[model samples]
Structures are given as C-alpha cells and as structure tokens.
Target: MEPNNDFEIFLVATPGLEAPLHAEAVEQGFADTKPVPGGVTCRGSWPEVWRANLCLRGANKVLVRLGGFPAVHLAQLDKRARKFPWAEFLRPDVPVKVEATSRKSRIYHAGAARQRIEVAITETLGAPVSSDAAVRVLLRIEKDLCTFSIDSSGEPLHKRGHKPAVAKAPMRETMAAMFLRECGFDGSEPVLDPMCGSGTFVIEAAEIALGLRPGRSRSFAFENLPSFDPNAWSSMRQQQPLAKPDVVFHGSDRNSGAIEASTKNADRAGVADFTMFQTRSVSDIKPPSDAAGLVIVNPPYGARIGDEKRLRSVYGSLGKVLQTKFKGWRIGIVTSNAGLARSTRLPLLPPGPIVDHGGTKIRLYQTGVLT
Candidate 1:
C-alpha cells in the first residue's frame, strides 16, 4: 500500500446516473474508468484520488480500494484484518470509523463483521475507533471476498462547503451538474431556470463556465490520510484564471425568499458576477439575451396523488411562455410526474432514466432547441 502505487479508485455516482458519472471521469482523464452498478471504478494512487475529490463535480464520493482478501468466516476475517497494513495509509493520531456490508457470503451478519474490523484497527494500528470519526473505512464482503476501501470525501461532494441556504425539495449540486451535462451544456451558452429554488442549476452552470473546481472551498477526508502530501495536494488545488462566458446564467422564482437565497448562494460560490436571480413568475420569464441557450427548470411536481391535476395549468403556462418567447432555446424539465411533463406540450423527446432524488424518483424531460 505504498503512496505511489496504483490502486483501485471508486467514484460513487448518484444512484441512476452512473453513465454520466463515468463520462465525467473519462473526460477528466482518469485512467481505466469503467461504470459499475452503483459507481465508476478507475485505477489511481493517492494523488489521483485527491484530484478526483477536488475536481469532479458529479462524483458523490471518492473511495480508494486499499486491499482485500478472502475470509469465509468471522475468525478468519478478524485474523486477516489485524494483518492489514493499516499504518501505511491511516494516521494513528486521527480517529477512524469502519462500516461493513456483507452479501451472499458465509459471514452474513454485517454488524458482527464491522465489530471485528473495528477491534482489529484499534488493537493492531493503535488508532481509536469512533462512530463519529470524520475518516471512514468501508468493507464490502460479497461472495466470500472481503474488500477494504477508504472514503476520501468526508462529507458528500454535494455539500460543496458553501450554499448555507436551501429551498424546499431543492436539487443537489451533484445532480444538477449531471443534469446540466445531459442537456448538452458545455459552459459556452446561457442557462436559465425559471422556477429555480435556491438557484442550484444557475450556480452550477456559472461555476462550470468559470472553470471553478467544485471542491475548492472545502476540505476532504483524504487530507487526514498518512499518504497525503501537503505540497503535492496544494499544487493540485492551485487555480487557473476563471473564464468569462459571453452570456450570464439566470434564475427566477416567484418566491422572493428563494431569490434571496439564490443571490446569497451565488455570492458565496464566487459566481455572483456571472449569475442573476430575480423574483418573477414562469409567465414573466423571458430570454435573458437575444442568443438562444438552455431553459432548464425543476418545477414543483406535487407529491400527493391529486396534485398533478392541479399543477397541469402551471405546466401549461410554462409551456405557453417558452413557445411564445423562447424559440430556438433548448428546454429541460425535471419532475417525478410524467403526466405533468406531458401537460407542458413542449414536444419533449423521450424521458431520461429514473433518478433518485431524496427518495422520490424523478426524470429529465428535455427537447431539442425549441422550434
């Protein structure tokens, strides 16, 4: 487990968005990337793991596969865990937490497996184990093979360490970044979200256009690892000059409070100079510039059964506005209800794959440039 040796690195994707996450990894030059069920896997050492945490906007978390072995039983697992080279990667001064998941294996009890590893780390490496430790070790036992990994991103990457204000049912920044990519956004065009709640889409678009690293404002769990090199990580985090897009990103909401929140968030993200938020209803929304760009909105799709019938008019109104004023601009609407999306009558292409958003299943309904 030397610092310079290549190991398996996993970038956890938002459930149902593995393809886009994998595409992002490849675009960012991560080597040997392959999309699996829950995430994308690649080969990288500690520096690559650190760069993934700092640069990739769509990754929910970056994990380093330390090593693994086969253990058919609990006693074997404990014996093997104690022999692991923990000191090579983990800091004895920093507390650690171990989480284990077992599937289709002889060691079926995940709790018992977790306990064995926790005891091994404390006793062998002299590192304290706590439930609330910022650094986490993940163990997965499947088909009698046990694999160990470290969570290099402490908090979820969606946190972004900024955005203190949020609105109801707000979009996660990671999801927003992927959705933007899915819409064919490449940081060269304006983006407008008419029903923007706390301005997640607008802020993300502005950051992309400005070439800002998503993790620039935050610290990461990899910083606590024994393999972490301060000088190398610092050089990796150094910023280039921000690009100034010709068009500015725009967001609007009928809720004045949401507008205030969006303004505050953009300021904190260092993209206020490139973004605009206003208190305006869907019908009042217009193209921010004469140039056509993207109109992506995450409108309210009611949770209750009868709410769709009531929201049809709202969707219809949005559709009518875009048809009349936003011709040639692309549109993407995110909602959980298919009927509500149909209500827009915006000639949407087939819906995207179902995406999990805070337990609700949603999809992206998009169209080519509005005709």
Candidate 2:
C-alpha cells in the first residue's frame, strides 16, 4: 500500500493512561485513535497536529511521526534514513538535532545510530545537523523497525508557558488535565481547586472553560519546519472561537504564596477575569454562588509534605468541611497515597486509573455529593 499524507500524532501521557488520552484525542476531533501502551496514536495533517498541541490538555508532548521503515542493521538504517523526505520537513538554514533510542533491535549503539541518521539528513537535504538546534527529530528503533518522528512541540505541552514558580510537588498541567477529564470536566460548569498549589488545576480548568488554546502563548518547534505554512496557521488562528465563559471558576489555597502564584498564572493565561483566587484553607472553603460545581484538590502528600499521619488528619478535616458546607457539589482529589485519600472518609468510587506524578503513582478520589 502507498503511504498516505497522514501524520501519526502520539499523545504522550503518563504510563497506563493511554486510553483516557485516546478518548480525549477523539473528543477533540481526531477521528482514528488507537491506544498504545504509553500513549495514543491519531492521524492528521500538520494543521491538525498544530491544533492538537494547542488544544490537548492531557498530553505531555505531541510527536509527529514522519515515517517508519524496517531496518535490521546500520546499513539498512542509513539507506532508509537517506530515502526519507528530509528536505520536505527540514530547511537548509535551520539546524536539526537527531535523537535516537533503541530497544531489542540490532541497532544497539544509540549514538552511532543517531550519527548515521544525522549524516543522512545533512548529506541528502543539505541541512546542517547541530546538537543545540531548536528543531529536534526523534528516532526510535524497536525490534529491527525504525520509527521517525518530529518534535512539533518545542517544549513539552505541560509547560503551558505561564507557571514560573511551583510549590513542592506541584501537579503537572498534563496530569491535572487528565484528572479533570476523569472527573468529567466538560467546560460547561464551574471548577474549584480548594488546595490549589500554584493554581495549575484551576488555571487549566479556566482555560478549558473559556476555550483558550494552551499553546497559543508559546512557540512550537514545527514553526521552523520547511513545510510550515504561516498563512494557513494565521487563518486557523483567526477562525478560532472567542466566546467568553459564563460560569464561576474558583481556586483557594492555605498558602498565600500559592494563591498569588495561581492568580499570576491565571492572569498570564488570560483567564484571570474568569477565575477567582483566594488565600483560604480547605477547612474554610465556601461554595461559590453556583448551586453545584467541581471541587478538585491536590493536597500535600507524604512524598512532598512530611508527616503522613498528621496529613491524614488534615484530610479528615477536609472531608468534614466538604460534607458540612457543600453537599450537592462534586469533589475530586488527586493524591499519590490512597490511604491518605481514604482518610477523607467519603464514599468514593474505584479510582479510574493510576497516573505518574513525578515518578509516583497517583489516583483520583471523588465524593458522591459535592458537600
């Protein structure tokens, strides 16, 4: 069969959360979604790839798979690399970096494999390969099959280009987004992060609610690609809906510094006008004017926050506050320690799945009622 112009988009997520990421990709309009072990695969063009980078919140990075070919040895690898349409993706003036990883394949020497691919790209396309280049091309060899992909997103999408400072063990933007999706955030209702450390969850929630593109404020690696069409991208940008949201989004933290950070991040994301930040402990949390909304909390865990026993008490106190104050609201808690979460004493459904938070496995706990 002939190769199609379709680009394979890899939505990188925490290990074991590929299904959720795949569902998210489909929900965002990418038709064909296949769940991989550590990520999801979808087909699209360069524009769709760009849009995914802008819109996907649960993805760690967006990799554009260029092509795949069978290569058992260096000789086959070099020949296949030379045949790839390097000129179509890389410009002579733009420097490119080749990164390679090998597993269970004859191409054992990763450094040598990268050098061969780099030489092929430079010699065939007349483009200089530099280690410090802004444009990066990734090569993966598994079981004598080589897969090539271009890093469309320069920085990981989790960076979000807004958070300058983070509290101890802060939840990553991608993880927070996944938790929100698991909690059923459809961007229609209000979201609350009661223990909003640096405000990542609240900011991401507000951005989703307002239909703001996460990648709008950052530059992408694909912008330097040879086939990049600035005019088409501008047209796409112009066509994006600018509708404002009409729901209340609130975040509060016991630490004043965290509240300040949340406020700054929301402002930087241009959703500050729609989000409310306050320096209040979870014990003091009060529901916003809305009859029902989400209460998502990423509280201090044993790894980051010391004294698990005392923290359990804090969680118990939090449970009391939620049950007494907000009865009809939905509650979602992100925590690495399941026991700590159970300390809340709220009847929670079985956690959806485990996600990686800085190498620790975290799960979501939800209360049946908001209160």
lDDT of every model, 2 decimals: 0.93, 0.83
Over 1-371, each residue of candidate 2 has an lDDT whose tens digit, in order, gives 11435777888888756776888888888858888888888888888888888788888888988887989889889998899878777898899999999999998999999999999988999888887888899999999889888888888889888778787778888888888888888787788788888888888888888777777778788889876889988877666666687886898888898888878887888888898989887778888855587889988888877789889999999988887888788889888898998889877878768877778878888876653
Predictions: Cα RMSD each: 1.4, 1.8
- Compared with the true structure, the alpha-carbon lDDT of candidate 1 equals 0.93
C-alpha TM-score for every candidate: 0.98, 0.95
Estimate the overall C-alpha local distance difference test score of candidate 2: 0.83
Expressed as tens digits, the lDDT of each residue in 1-371 for candidate 1 is 43447989999998889999999999999999999988999998788998999999999999989888999999999999999999887998999999999999999999999999999999998899989999999999999999999999999999998899999888999999999999999999999999998999999999999999999999999899998999998888885558888889999999999999999999999999999999999989999998899999988988833477779999999999999999999999999999999999899999999999888899999999888
Which pairs clash in model 2? 322-371, 326-371, 327-371, 329-370, 330-370
In candidate 1 the C-alpha lDDT for residue 326 amounts to 96
